[model samples]
Target: MPIFIDGHNMRGISPTDLEKIVNSPKDNFGITHLEVFYNESEDKLYCVLDAPDEESVWKHHESFGLKCEFITSVKQIKTAKDLKEEKFQILGEFASQLSHDLRNPLSIIKNSVDMMSIKYKDKLNADIFENFAKMDRSVIRMNMLISDVLNYARTQSLILEKYSISEIIQASLEGIKIPDGIKLVIPEHDFSLKCDGTKLQVVFYNLITNAIQSIGENNSGEIHILCMKKDDIIQIDVQNSGPPIPDEVLPKIFEPLFTTKDHGTGLGLPSCKNIIEQHHGIIRVKNNPTTFTILLPKDVEKLSSITV
Candidate 1:
């Protein structure tokens, strides 16, 4: 679990009012309050808590009839960024180390399972084989999530190149299994983009996979893609005709380690945002048709003027 620092705006809040809520008996919400800060000039309260998820933090605040202005998950310390040239080095190092440590053991286990499957195929029953298949799938998913974490932590510069939009999209859809009856409309545009082709491929892949999953179990849906280039910038839109994302969840969808799915690492959108911003590009989502729009500059010289 990670620690989250949430901010709340309370008008005319007195010290006793804050103390009373802070001193209240703790419950089983799995929320531990570390500290609270009050700014007299602005009349804002900042609270830091350690909890398993954001919902628990919300419930902890509601337990005392307190209203929250907003809550966001905290990452590494920013104070170091002001003092040094690099930021989040310690945090990134920890994530990379942990990912490396986990990968070795997972690989060994997967190899062992494969060997057993081959050695005991005649003796193993159907139920045992099914469980083995499930394990292999879990291992593959875990490996993917580890790679996602490493990619998110990377602060390296981009290796930009000139590539066509059609080429990028085609490469991204290589192994993605789109369901039958699902229509994907990709316009034949002859636009060339100067960016990291591999990283951009990742962005499109995630958006496409999410669109495919958003369609119900029936797998009957339509995805519309539109691309345009003007004013020295290229914009790509991916829209899916499926259930719209919840209104409340739209704000927190890009936060790291925040997810609505049962088996998600919550790093997909965050990584996408990081990679795009590193290239001086912008990514946004809109409802009504559930579209993801990516805007990128055609030349690297304009990177300084573009604000991430």
Candidate 2:
């Protein structure tokens, strides 16, 4: 068994009520609640549990109708003292190191796949070639997962630059291949803002990719991206003609490591949220057409000065 620490926003739940729930001997997921630390002021709960794996931890929490902000496997339990900031710092460092370590091997696998593709272009049969293509897709997906982890873990300062909304959306779309039966529409109007163009591009890319995935392959869908400037804030909406997000899953969609997809790393939306907040902006989602809206400050320089 491994030790894990999971976090949850307590909402209005009191410590006594939480204790009562945890005291129940419900080992459905083979998870044992060992210790819990509650921050009354912050209304955040940290639970130390003995579980079979991270998935079991998630199931255990889900069984209790609890949404976890994050669930991380820890090697050892340090202290029971209240150290919220330090706890997050430790988790961030662990994620950064883990991602960095995995990239080297991933690169080797990717390069080997490329070489094989070139060398066996003429010799391989159709089935073998298809398998090789699958392998290449897997490598690409793994690389994407690694990038998401690194982006979420590392806290790098923004490189503020002037860029038009149209330009950013265009650059983001260049990397993605829109599947057949899917149509993408971009806003005719453009707005300029001073922000981290690279990070912003990642936000748009994730949103657009999610929209495409939601539409699926067989369905004829349209992805409409709309932009507008209101007062000192600029709003961007990425809407898709896909099934609405389930009511049960909507609230936890932005939480880290929360996903309904089989192969999803569950860090994409969280990373987007982090980047938007870093720019003094907010990212939110709504159903009834499946729209993701982002509101960012029009003048980052002024916002930065005021915050300082």
Candidate 3:
């Protein structure tokens, strides 16, 4: 059996003593190799413990000598991008299976409902019909979200292709679900840049969606996009009207796993950064008291180095 051990989170054991416990026989039981995962801050180590059984696990954990919070696994156990990718492949396979399996049944229900409405419109109550229709819509949304998840996973998987900047922005607007009050204004201009078009679109969509989500329900706002060129460089600006992101948060926005929204994955902006860099361009965010602007600069020199 595979057992995970938290080396530092155990209570009632000194560091030296804990070493002795792990080194010697644990509770006079036959224990195989133990897996240890740990992170330390301010001289205290946060740890996660995985063991075979409740009895043996608890007994061994108590021997660590520190009052530790035992958990099955950590939320994110990565120190490098490569390790994260490996874990992503493992988990994403499971999600792909689940999404595929769910879609089959959902499609059947949708088909059945579509057929029934025509045959029995008079008998089916409006509320019941609405519920069925809503279910179909919800399932479709879930399918799209799952596809988004797959695209997200595959994007980080080191794939690259050539794409145009103009098409990407158009696709982004189409893919994004904007709130009623927020409007997106796209400019007409000749702006040409190269990138992984699909992933770049995701970045645009994420940024634009964030703009829409930032406005309060009662507040109205607008997002303006423009493509401009000066000499050899092309600039794409996505500006949104909303409360400015605080100064403190601005610096951290590009950092992976940093988010201002609840239930957000925190990958959107960083992913955008990565996509733009991959395509020989640089993406930046700027904000004023009531507006946020994302700038993408086209430069072969900087773009090549950052992507590598």
Model 1 stretches astray by more than 4 angstroms: 1-91, 98-147
Tens digit of per-residue lDDT, candidate 1, span 158-259: 788899988988877763656787888985675987888877777887788789888854669999889998788888999999899999999998987778
lDDT of 2 by residue, 167-228 (tens): 99987775576788999999988999999887788788789989999999667899999999
Scored by Cα lDDT, where does model 2 land?
0.83
- Cα lDDT of model 3 overall? 0.61
Better of 2 and 3 by TM-score: 2
Name the best candidate (by lDDT). 2
Q: Compared with the true structure, what per-residue lDDT tens digits does model 3 show for residues 216-249?
A: 5457888887777765566777777888888999
The candidate with the higher lDDT, 2 or 3, is: 2
Residue 291 displacement (Å), model 2: 0.6
Question: How far is 45's C-alpha from truth in model 3 (Å)?
Answer: 16
